[model samples]
Target: MCRCIRLQALIGLLFLIFMVPEFKAKAQVETIASQRQLFVDDFLVDQLERAELEMHRPVDEGIAFNLDKLWEGKFSLYTTIIKDGGTYRAYYRGLPDVKEGNDRELTCYAESKDGINWYKPNLGIHEINGSKDNNVILVDNQLTHNFSPFLDTNPNAKKSERYKALAGKKVTGLYALTSADGIHWVKMQEEPVLKEGNLDSQNVSFWSSSENKYLVYFRTVDSGFRSVSRASSTDFNSWDQGVEMKYGPTPLEHLYTQQTSPYFRAPQVYLAIGGRFMPNKQVVSDEQAAIMGIDPNYYKACSDAFLMSSRGGNNYNRYFMESFIRPGIGLNNWVSRTNYPALNIVQTGDTEMSIYVNHDYAQTTAHLRRYSMRLDGFASLSAGYAGGEMLTKPFVFDGSALELNYSTSAAGEIFIELLDEKGNKIPGFSKEECQPIIGNELERTVYWNKNTDVSKLIGKPVRMKIYLKDADIYSFRFY
Candidate 1:
C-alpha cells in the first residue's frame, strides 16, 4: 500500500510538471542599433500604460515656386529636391499645354541656395518655347511624366553618374538615365530595365547603403486602387521584378502616390507620405471651381497626404489613418491632385524641415508650396496631464547615453526606466531613481539619478519604460 501511494504521488507530480502552466524564458533580442526610430506607431511597442498616439501637422510657409515659366504650368508634378553639399537642386515635370507624347512634356529644373527662396536657373541645356532661356533640363524624350532623380551616394559611384534618374511612361517602360551635374542627362542603358508592372508612376530609385545596392519604389494597383511595389538592382541597368507591398491587416484604400524614401535622420525607417486619393470625394462645387478660377476637370478627385513607414523589405506600416496633411480652407487646394507632396523632405532650417506640395493644379496660378515641421516631428508618443507610461520591445543597442527629441509644457515632465529583457525594472535605473525631464529639444540626453552614461548596459538586451505627463516624444535614440 505504501509503494502504491508513492507511485500515485510520483505520477501526479510528473503530470503537473509536464502539463501545468509554466513560465517560458524570454526571447533573445536583435542586436541592431536603434539610432533613429520613427513614431509611426506600436511597431516597437511592447506595452502601453495609458499613453496614446499623437499626429503633427505641417505649417505652410509660402509658395516655393511659380510654374508660370516656359513649358511649365499647372500640369507640373513629381517635384524632387536635394540638398547637394551647399547648393539645393529642385526637379519637376513641365507641361504648359497638355496634349500627348514626349513633345508636350519637359523636364524642368530649379535651384535654391537656402531652400526658402528658389530660382529657375537657365541651364541653356534644352530648348523650350523656341528659346534656351527656360529652366528645362531634358526635352524631346521619355522623362516628362515622371523624371525622378537622386544624388547618388554610393561610395563606388562614378563621377559621371553622380546624379541618377529613372524616367518612363506606361507604354515605354522605365529607362535609366545618368547625369554628371544633374543638368545634362543621358541614357545609361538602351532598353528598359523594368517593365510590365505598372511603370506609369513616379519610379524613384536610390543607392541604399544598408543593402549595398540600388532600391526602387514604384506604383501598382491593388483591387483597382493605386498601391506600391519595390525592386532592386546592382548596376542600375538590371533589376528584379518588384514585389507588391503588404500593409499588414489594414484594409486597402486608394493610395495614388506612395513617396517611400529613406528618412534623412533615420534611413532604416523609410518614410512614406503618400496621396490618399478619393476618386469622387469632391468638396468643391462646379460653380465654386469657376468662381475660384480653377479647372473643372481638376476638381473631380481629392487627395491628402498620409503617413507610412517601412524598415527595408516590401512592407509598410500605416499606423495612423488620420491625415498627415490636409487640403486646407481654400478653393485652389480643394481641387483634385493639387495637394500632392514632393518626393523628398529636405532639411531647410536648424530646427525645421520642409516638404513641398503641388498646389492649385490646372489653374493659372499653379505653383509648388512649402510646408514646414520640426525636425523628426512627424508623429509623437504623447500623454495628457494625468500622466501615462510606455514600454518598448527588447532591443540591443550600442550606445552610452540616451537622447530624445521631445517637447513638453512648462508643468509637464518625462521619466525613464531601463528594464531587463524580461521586463523587470533594473536596480539602479528604476523610475524612482529618474530625474524629471523638462524642456523642448531636438536632442536632449536623458539622465537617471544624475547619471547620463549607460555604457555598462550597452550590448545587453534591455527595454525602456517612458513616463510622460502632458509631454510629446517625437523620437528616441541611443548614442
Candidate 2:
C-alpha cells in the first residue's frame, strides 16, 4: 500500500511539471491594446493564403531646397527635418570644402510653412566668413561635423531642453546638446554621454514613448562593415551600454547612416531609411567626375537609400532589400555618398506624407529632394484580382471600432471576419456579415452587419481574418 501511494504521488508531480508550461503558453497571447499595427513586417501576421506583404516606393516630388547658400555648399549633409507644430524646421551640416579639420563645418538651418518649399532663415547666431547673416546656427568645429537634432516630445522634458541633438566624431565621442527653442542650443554636459564605437556618421536620437527611454542609433563598425548600435537612457545624460544591431541572415553591408526615427503615425515602430554604401562600385569615370567638378575622393564609391524598421531594441527587419529611393538618372547621383535619406517623415497633406533625401552629393547641385508617400503606405498586405486571405495572430485589444488605412480599386473590395482564440468564427462577425469596404481612404472604419461597435469584444483574445481582392491594406488599428 505504501509503494502504490508513492507511485501515485510521482505521477502527479510529473503531470504538473509538463502541463503547466503548455497552459501558460496558451495564455501568452499578445496584449496589443489600442496600438496601431503596421504591415511593415510579419510581426502581427500568422498566416497568408495567396496574399503578400508588398513594399511601396515613395514618389519623387522634386527639390525641397538647394544647397545654394554660401556656407551651404557641395558637402552639406546630415539633414534633419522636424515638423514642430505648424512650422517645419530643417537642420544640416554645411561644409563648403572637405578639408583636414572640422573648423569650417557649420550647422545651418532652414524652415518652411509647407514641407515642399523650404527657405534658409538668417538666424545670425554664428558667424561665417565674417558675416552672421547666414543661416548658420552653431559653429563649433567638433560638434558641427555631424550635428543631428530632433524636437523633444517627452512629457517630463524641461522647457529649456525642448530640442535635443547628438553630435561628435570618433575622437570626441558623442556629445549631447539642448535648446529651449529649436534654434539656440547649449551642451547638456561638458562630457560626452556615451562613446563605445566609431561615432563618425549622423547619430540619430529620439524620445521613445513606447520604450519610455531616450534611444540613440549611431555608427559602429561591425565585422569590417559599417553598422549601427543602439543605446538607451532614462535621462539624456546617462546611457546604458549599447548593443550592436542585428540584421538577421542578411549579408553585411556598409550602412553609412541609419536615419532611424519613430514613425509619427505609429511611434512604436522605428523606420530607418538608411544609406547603403558600396565601396569600389564606381559609376562615373574620372573624366565625367572632373567635368561635374566632383570632389576627387568622393566619386569612387556609390550609395543609395534602403528601407528598414524595428519595433524596439537591437534587431532591425529588412523586409525589402531593394533600394527605397534609387539614385535616379544622373551621373552626379551615382557618385559616392549621394542619395542618403534625411532624418524624418512628416505629414504634408491630408493624405500625403513626405520623405526628404540628400541628392547630387559632392556636386554643384547638391540639394534635398522631397518624396511623397500615402500616409502609412510604407508597406502593405496586398492581394491580386484573384481574392486571398490573411489571418492575424491572436491578441487582445481595447477599442470600440476597427479603423483601416487602405486603398482598393473600384472593383476591388475588402472584408473582415473576427475569430476567437481557437480560430473559430465568432457569430455576427463572420465575413458574410461584413460590409464590403471599397475606396481609397486614410482611415475607414470597418463594420460588420452594418454595425461598427466592437466594444463588446474588447479584452477578449481574438484574431482578424482579412479577405481582399485587388486591394492593399497599409495598416489597421483599434480605436
**How accurate locally, in lDDT, is each candidate?**
0.84, 0.91
Put down candidate 1 lDDT per residue, 61-174, tens digits, no spaces: 989989998588778888888888778899998887463244688888999988889999878876665777878887756667889999998898999999998889778888
Best prediction by lDDT? 2
How much does candidate 1 score in TM-score? 0.93
**Over 4 Å off in model 1, which ranges?**
1-22, 25-28, 99-102
Worst 10 residues of 1 by lDDT: 21-30
RMSD of each: 3.4, 3.4
Residue 10, model 1: lDDT of: 95
In model 1, the Cα lDDT at residue 239 comes to: 91
Error of 1 at 135 (Å): 0.5
- Tell me the tens digit of each residue's lDDT in model 2 across 1-479: 99999999999878877776643345347878888888988887889999999999999999999998877888889999999988999999888856424578888999999888888877878777887888988888779989999988999999999999999988998999999888998999999997788988899999999999999999999999999999999998999998999998888999999999999999999999979999999999999999998878899999999999999979999888888888899787899999999999999999899999999888889899999999999999999999889998899999999999999999899999999987899998999999999999888999898899999999999999999999999999999
